[model samples]
Target: MNVMAKAEKKISSAFIYFFGSFGGILFGYDIGVMTGALPFLQADWHLENAASLVGWITSAVMFGAIFGGALAGQLSDKFGRRKMILMSAIVFVVFSVLSGVSPDMGEASAYYLIIVRMLLGLAVGAASALVPAYMSEMAPAKARGRLSGLNQTMIVSGMLLSYVVDFLLKDLPGEWAWRLMLGLAAVPALILFLGVLRLPESPRFLLRKGDEAQARKVLSYIRKNPAEIDQELASIKETAKEERQANQKTSWSSLFSGKYRYLVIAGVGVAAFQQFQGANAIFYYIPLIVQKATGQAASSNLMWPIVQGVILVVGSLVYMWIADKFNRRTLLMVGGAVMGLSFILPAVINWMMPNMNPMTIVVFLCIYVAFYSFTWAPLTWVLVGEIFPLAIRGRASGLASSFNWIGSWLVGLIFPIMTASMPQEAVFAIFGIICILGVIFVKTCVPETRGHTLEEIEEQGTNHGRVKASNPEN
Candidate 1:
């Protein structure tokens, strides 16, 4: 009987991790699907000369995400994380189908498609903000980093799947290929919605809502020993009580208060830098970069994204192994240095030998992707999940995620224009500089959050700030 119970508990735990991070699959799929679809869309719609429209088409989703992230944070605070995830899945399914079936009526069709993609972006942004927080709240403190890192793993997996799907469907006649690529997102969205239906509400969220009985019940399924469960519940209740006494409303204004100012800077700064380092330029526009480098047709370059996707998945596996073992700050510093060198080397190589093989740039890009997958991509989510106080975590994470999407939107909107006006090497040099700055930010500002409970981290952040202010000499 005890053996049967242990097996059931293990299965339940696995189920939670799988479904909890499924939103990331949708996030990665939407982002990667565009990389493959854009080439075909350009050819079909006669957008070769329309750099502005192409940029808008690619970035419209990110713009929509800026709003979605803010709104989902507020909604998840009130309606619960599980409901918000369900809402995001529904949004993904409806808009994905709409994006696929957009009327091919010339420039008008491009405008219509932008509108649909923005709606899809709304879902992606919400999932980005909500999933990590949900997973962090539900996971054990010891395993939180690994479980939260699963979101990144699923994200890369989704990207890999989308790339493979695009490669397989590249030969389809007319616009159906891009349409299928865009519409296929509905499959995973549906799966997420159904999977989340069986999941319980987050215990921390339940405790915050003054439902101790339900919180304990939920904790029982996730926690192993009853003693540990009670201890955690007591800690949560105490945190909730303090939050109530503080009477701090969760809002943008609250995030900027003296107490949370530094944390806000660290979280939002890291989130923005993750995008500004130009990884998305590779993920979203790699084929275009390849087309410029090798002078090859975009259709022939589908395999390149698959190669990068493999590297992303492999790097994420490495991250899972070390995430809980090392200080988050230490990993970011090492990753930032490697990532900076990767970008800088490519620019230097191109400058020294302008006519070098395009594969050289591809090799550097693969290196950049490898370092970034384990570091900024996964760790950013982990920090955002771990750094914020419980009182402001949902809204603060939303704001941080908004900054991330905003940076992504800027990169997606401007990269084609930059490439059109300047050398690709110059463009990458700019990102290399940003990567160096990212390393500095990690060293000076970001906190170490390995192996700490969310509540404990919050207290330490608050008290440390107080101590620093009181003892400026230290």
Candidate 2:
């Protein structure tokens, strides 16, 4: 009986991990698909109208992402994670298809493009918030970091797959090529939408709704044995009850209340720093940056993002392996410092060797991306997912994710203008500064939550000054 129980537990864990990561896969595809497609899009649409147009076009989804993140918590709580995911998947697929097939530069096409991208942004934002939260909820304490890290890994893998498709299709030399690249997202979105249909609702979510029977059924599906399911449920229920007692009301202001203030600050601050770290600026414009640096053709530029994507995927895997082994604080510092250094070297190369071989700069950029993937890309998700309690997990994660997208939107909006107006070297140097600040913030403010249970995080979280002793807000 014990032997069979162990096998069943392992299988259940594997299933959760795979599916949890799939959510990130959608995120990755959404992010990377645009890089290659953008160059073609710019040319196809004759997008030289004004900087505002360019900014609007690029930042449109980001703008939508802000609201999407905000909506994730409320919707996930009201509608459930599985249902929201299904709905978002449909939105993602529909928008992806629309984004690809919208007519060229006509009023209708332009309007449709913005609308579709906005919808896509909503899907991306919601997924970013819910995927990690869902993954963390499903994962056991022992394996939570690794499984949640799967979201980041899938995100990178999606980026890689998108880049690969971009490369393969870059030679088609028509608007349809970009369309095809964007439309390809439909395949994964559809697969995920259908795959998750059979998966159980989150046990924690079920428990929250006072549906113990449903929660038990979910636990049974996720665990191998009925006995193990019973044990886990008891533990989870106890934890949930404690969380409910700690605070039952979910609100934006509640996050700023006595007990959860510091956590809110930490969560939101880290999320903001993540984007301010200049990751998206690089991601959004890397292909263009590569083309400028390497003096390469579009096809060649397309290949570099694919290479970068591959490096990011590998980096995420390596980071996942080490995340729980080392302190979260230590890893963040290391990653920030390394990424900071990566940006500096590239800036220096561009400045001192402006006339030197372009390949040298490209090589350094690749190294920078490789380092980023290993550190910030995956670690951020793991940290965010594990740092909050069950009661506030949805709202807190949503708010934090909102900050992340806001940062992304700002960077995406400004990168073109910054790169166009300022020297490229200066632009990168600014990112380096942000990365250094991130390192300092982690060292000073961030707490180590390595290997802690959700219950433990809630207890420690209150100690960080996020919770108040007197007034009740949420």
Candidate 3:
């Protein structure tokens, strides 16, 4: 009986992690598919003279995400995270196909494609906000960081998958290649939608709705020990009861009140900096950057993103190993410092050795990617997932995610224009400075969340002065 129970427990836990992170795969695939598809579109459509159009095609998804994130957050709070995620998966499938089949109705083709991509972006944005929250609510305190980190790992893996898919499909003649790239996202979306049917709604969310019996039943399936399950249920109940007694409703405006102001700043700041530090620019334009540096055609440049993708995946693995073991602040500061140095050194080298091989910049980019994958990429999601109180988590996380997409939107929108007018080295140097500022922000403001339950973290927020001094579990 004991053996059977243990096996069932392990299988159930694995199921949760797998489907919980699957939303990230769709997110990554849609984001990366564009990187390879854009070149083909430009060629087929004769968009060489339309730099503004090119930027719009890439950034339209992000512009839609800003609204998607905000809307998904409020909806999840009302309907449940699992339902919102399931809905997003359906949206992913519908729009991904729409994006791929956009007819070449002359000048209208670009506009059609942009609209479809924006629709797809809405799904991606919802997943970005909801998945981490779902995972954090389901995870044990000791394993929460690693479980939340799984979302990032899946995100990078999806990106790498897209890069590999793009490489494999690059040889196909004409517009079919790009269409297939955009359309392939549907496979993962369908898988996520199917898989989610077997998963339970978040127990925390269930408790919030005043359904302790259902919440307890869900907890029993996920938790290994009966005593631990009881303890977790009690903790959740206590938190929810306290919130109910306060008799205050959580709304978008509540996020800006004095009580939540600092946390809002911290959450939104970290989320925004994660993008503004310029990682997506590399993911979106690696081929272009390599083309300029190596004088290679788009065909040959396809292989280069795979190399960066591998580095990103490997670095995320390293993060999984260390995430729970170290303080969040420590990891972010170390990653920020190293990442800044990686960007700064290449620019310095370019200035001092103007004749140096352009490949040197790529080398530094790999280093920057390594540290970033391990640190900012995964940790930012982890923090955002665990930081907010349940009362406002959905809305606050959504707003923070919206801020992230907004940053991504600006970067995607302006990167081509900026690179056209300024030296690439100068642009990277600016990102390097942002990385340094990230370090200061993590050190001075971010709280340590290791070994604490989501409820405990929420309680700590009521006394902001003690947040920085909180100790990690041994």
Candidate 4:
């Protein structure tokens, strides 16, 4: 027992876990910072004429992420997840500093911030994909779910921290509050960079690269006994060989035909709809939306975001309890129904009265957020992970992630323009409609993944997707 303690403590699993999931915190912080920074940024840069570019500035990071995720997969496969994450951390820190201090070039300052943000988006994109793989690779099989769930927890917590920071600094004179809010994201990135230096290369990555000796060493540190270490190493060797052989047969074209086509559509569709259901619309613009609705001066309060951030974090915690306990399809459809109703109520009320209390709209939006956090947000990835064939898991997961980010990018870009042209409730009405479509999509397309092993899902989906595709009405 003493020796086992010594072995585990030598590398410190907690230390490894912290840095492994740290990327989520950075990504979350980046996500929330803009909510506070945007109003001040527009004021500081005098971006009145370039209001059209506001969406670009808000969404440029997501746009850059599309390319970042694509490249990170190939690069990480060749290099390593740890190395690529370190590179991403460096990029986050540098671009964050640049974003905070973007020079005032009149309206072009928006363009400058947009460019900086898009570059930073590269890191955000990489983290979204890499963190899960890194955390999963480092964890033992029995604990994989709990450990991987930490990444999601950290993401929402980071967002909450950013909101708190924005609230604390709301009173600072001039644009300094927003600058500090934007720039401080570098703090976590820097810590992640430093902390990751102590992290060993994942044993799975080592074994894949034919470094069996190093892989054995890492397993010793992470596992309890020789039996556990040897068993895991052998399993990894087998899985790695299967992945190599499978990679040879899989390609982008494979996802277009056979059972792969139907599965990919379902997987990618759920991923895309998770974002398109209008979660980020609320996440990124809660404060601004509240102020616009309530006629509350921006300078007077930035508190609504803090409230929503709490709901997101709390809701994520609740998801952890119910994650493996329920049918994912049921939870998602129910969430969609509730979310659609939440948005529709506010939209209808405002359309009829046009003078309803702004707080009432805020309440319905919160309800939308509460359901979204546990259901589609986390379950999309859970279902995606479960539905793919073992050989194609890596590729399919990447594809789904890309679709997710693209959906988020489109929503972020379009929501502001949507609200500007229509009444706020009208915009909510559109999102509500999308939420309803999400429910139908799940009912018709997504498979129930509860109580099924990965092999079972793939085996069933192999013929099922083909039959469903052929019959159409089925």
Q: Tell me each candidate's TM-score.
A: 0.91, 0.88, 0.89, 0.95
Compose the digit string of candidate 2's lDDT tens values, residues 1-474.
778555434445566567655877888887788788888877777664445566666777887878886787678988888888888889888888887788765645666777788888999888877787677677666666667667777888988998898889988975778889889999999988977766667888898889988788667766668888888888888987877775656666787776777666776778788888888776767878877666664545787787788788888888877765788777778878887887777678767767767666567667768777776776676678778767777678777787888888888888888777876767888888888999998887677777677678778878655444544362
lDDT of 4 at 210: 91
**Per-residue alpha-carbon lDDT of candidate 1 for residues 182-300, written as tens digits (9 for 90 to 100):** 99999999999999987888998898888987788778888889999999998888877877655565566888776787787888899999999999999999888899888999877
Tell me which residue pairs clash in candidate 4. Answer: none
Of 1 and 4, the candidate ahead on lDDT is 1
lDDT (Cα) of model 3:
0.83
The regions of model 2 sitting more than 4 angstroms off are 1-16, 48-50, 248-260, 389-394, 451-474
Q: How accurate is candidate 2 locally (lDDT)?
A: 0.76
Residue 430's lDDT in candidate 4 = 86
Model 4 vs. true fold: TM: 0.95
How many residue pairs clash in all the candidates, one count each?
A: 0, 8, 0, 0
Quote model 3's TM-score. 0.89
Count of clashes in candidate 3: 0
lDDT, each prediction:
0.87, 0.76, 0.83, 0.84
> Sorted by lDDT, highest first, which candidate order results?
1, 4, 3, 2
Summarize candidate 4's per-residue lDDT along 158-229 as a digit string, tens digits: 998898888888878647977889899999999999988778889999998999987888777678899998
Q: Write one digit per residue (lDDT tens) for candidate 3, span 1-474.
A: 777546434547789889988998988887788788877888888875576788889988888888887788889989999999999999999999898898988769999988888888889888888887788889887776667667888999999999999899998875898899889989999999999977888999998998987788778877888899899999988877876654367777878765676677788889999989888888887887777677876555788788888888898899888876888888889999998888788789989999989888888888888899998998887788778777777567777787889999988888877777788888888889999999999887777777777767766676773543463231
**How many Å off is the CA of 27 in candidate 4?**
0.7
The full ranking of all candidates by TM-score, starting with the best, is 4, 1, 3, 2
